[model samples]
Target: MYATFPDLLRLLFVPALAWAAYHDLRVRRVPNELWYPFAALGLALLAWEYVLVERTSLFLVRAAVSLLVIPLAYLFWFVGGFGGADFKAFCVVALLYPTYPSYYLADLALPLVRTQLGVFSVTVVTNAMLASLGYPLALGLRNALAGVVSKLMFVGRPVAVRQLAAAHGSLLETPEGFSRGGLDLDALRMYLRWRGVTLGRLLAQPERYRDPATVPAETNDPGDGSVTTEPIPDPASEPAPREDADEYDDPWGAARFLDDIDSTAYGTTPRKLREGLDVITSQERVWITPGVPFIVPLFVGLLLALTAGDLLFALMRLIGLV
Candidate 1:
């Protein structure tokens, strides 16, 4: 565990970053607002290493890996292989867990017990051991931990998980965790007013009801709030509400849609999905093709492999029975 600290540093940071990335993706835009704090966090990690630890390799390696992962991460995001922000967060994570190879390639040059491949041997064995113990082992461990935490906290009512089943127009039965952001009517209106969407119609078809979360569910409308009665049908009832369904599928289908067709050299409109890529070369300059010399190789290439190898040695050296 002590030896795993450096890798853990990365493990802790990237998931937090990835969460932000997922939020940015949902909005179909990355917020410029978030960039500053993370940049500072990255800087702080470096500063701490220099000022406190004096291990320049830790600072330098972390910093260098962080910087290097960005472009490749972006490329993965661009190609739709991952969310833009997920790629960004994962790049940093790669630095954290060289053995995990978070966002990059394994060191092909150094294989055997000297690189990540070697370290993975331990992970495989450990996971196998866990599997052998079976589901009961994990459940027992979790229940035990939860019981301890509850005891320390002085157990109250278990927090109810609320879900708002605002499926129908009038009878919006909020699940345990559902709410309309108070009596704010504007939030509902925002969904109704969103441009290009037949939201009102979708509203008529409550089955197609989206989360109050599509946009900020806030409002200036002051009233007791609207009301009615009826459960909204499941959104799937329609001929697959084209808008909501296509939002992701459309983009993804773009690649597969063209996979069957042979494009003419004479400037045939290759379709929208095909448009994201440059058609000049058959090479994957866009989504779908795992571009050669991927970001992982360039970023954490050597370190990742070594970390893996070390894990195996650690088992042999540390975990071996005396």
Candidate 2:
């Protein structure tokens, strides 16, 4: 008979997956605070599943699954095929869902391979990988329908630089792996130097809120912390010549002119504004790479594995391959 998670176990595990997916989508990072606690709980639940439920045979099967899967997850991470969070997520999945969790529904149409293997986490991973194929395929189809080709190579269409920066996706590129709106590392370095702020400091304190206009550009060498530029200029006393364009400029618009020679004559522009200007100038158009958070696919995979069983197994059966 096929096995599944108990009701209590499902309740705990599903919510955790939902939370991880949300965090990964929003910030591209999941904090230790969320996963670490969930991991502890997962171990506890697995223990209970084995000891209290007295599913000794299932427990052994699950243990074997964990031994097989966790190392593979680690190997993916080690080989740079997986991100840190994605790797940890898989590890957690191995512990929490070593075998398919139970649902009190009629058995779904499953293939002979799955019935023979009966490893829950393996089916979930396979299903998620299969589901993920839809994203790029859809993007390619859209590009084909739109009559767009050449630079994007039918993987993605050229999008405006501003739009690309404001949105999120894997940036597309030519065969040479270059795109118009993609960040120009060399140009970015020069911009960062002129502003006298290092990327390290900016990242170290990303949460600090600052008015884009008011952030003072660094006058010190980020390399050795020595004075490299003049002190912050004051516009009140030595007013920089205002351009006619400044009259129509909003805060973001004003940022475009921050690098203007005359504007910096009176005062240093804000660091934040400088950064925005750098990004805007980085590229005119970009090929958005087709990538999605792996967690998203994994979450979908988990649900399908619970409701439908192994996708590849079912497909094989449908095609009379197994």
In the range 217-262, model 1's lDDT, one tens digit per residue, is 2222211112223222223222233454523432312233233234
Q: Model 2: per-residue lDDT, tens digit, 111-186? A: 2235457667788889889998887677777887878766454455667754432344434443344553333222
Local distance difference test scores for all models: 0.33, 0.56
Query: Which 10 consecutive positions of candidate 1 have the poorest summed lDDT?
Result: 163-172
Q: Once all C-alphas are superposed, what RMSD does model 2 give against the true structure? A: 11.5
Q: Give candidate 2's TM-score.
A: 0.62
Model 2: per-residue Cα lDDT at residue 293: 69
Question: Can you tell me which runs of candidate 1 are displaced by over 4 Å?
Answer: 1-32, 57-62, 91-322
Shift of residue 141 alpha carbon in model 1, Å = 26
Alpha-carbon deviation at 238 in model 1, angstroms: 24
